[model samples]
Target: IQQKEHPKFKRKGDDLFVEHTLSITEALCGFQFILTHLDNRQLLVKSQPGEVVKPDSFKAINDEGMPMYQRPIMRGKLYIHFTVDFPDSLSLDQSKALEAVLPPKMTAQISEMELD
Candidate 1:
């Protein structure tokens, strides 16, 4: 039997994928939330402290996906892909505060520029 749609997750084979969006601060500082699984189970999807999830990064929760066809107790993996939403710009005060908490920016070196 084949099903058409699901409210929270998209599936492939037995594996499930969910696209999660996080703010820049959340991505950088780490994120945590409860996800409603395919079987109506609430699962914790979290990142380690100080573990920054960069834009378009992926995390996985094993044995949390759909159950196998014949083996009702066996399940696949749940994959979470993160999309970091960064603001276009920050105010001077905000920038300063962020700078203080973050590592120093890496500077690029260049000698000269030629315009056409």
Candidate 2:
């Protein structure tokens, strides 16, 4: 896991800005598996961290038939899982535009396990 600190700003008074520092942490989880054949005892092995997000989290269903509550996880971030993976060569402007459409913290935390 890696943590980075960034300065945050808020408007105060007529033309003043207040600043504070915030931290962000990133972690990588890995998994490995092996398949073995009984006849020759041959083994096939694979290892991966998997994709950042799962697809089903973005699926939409009729509210009438769906359960009263639903939870989803995306990009290792809970509740804020609605994201589209563009090609590796996407431009910086394109990426920023997509990020602008993300849900706010409260909506994103709708499925969070932590109380606070």
TM-score, prediction 1: 0.84
Report the lDDT tens digits of candidate 1 across residue range 1-116.
76878766899988899999999988988788988876677888888988999888889888887889899899998899899999999999999998998799999776567332
lDDT minimum window of 10 residues, candidate 1? 107-116
Question: Runs in model 1 with CA error above 4 Å?
Answer: 112-116
Candidate number with greatest TM-score: 1
Poorest stretch of ten by lDDT in candidate 2: 19-28
1-116 in candidate 2: lDDT tens per residue? 24233242222211212221111111112222232321234333322344233422322212211112233221111111123333556589976865686454354435455755
Per-prediction tally of clashes: 0, 0
Candidate 1 residue 55 C-alpha distance from true site, Å? 0.9
Q: How close to the true structure is residue 16 of candidate 2, measured as C-alpha lDDT?
A: 17
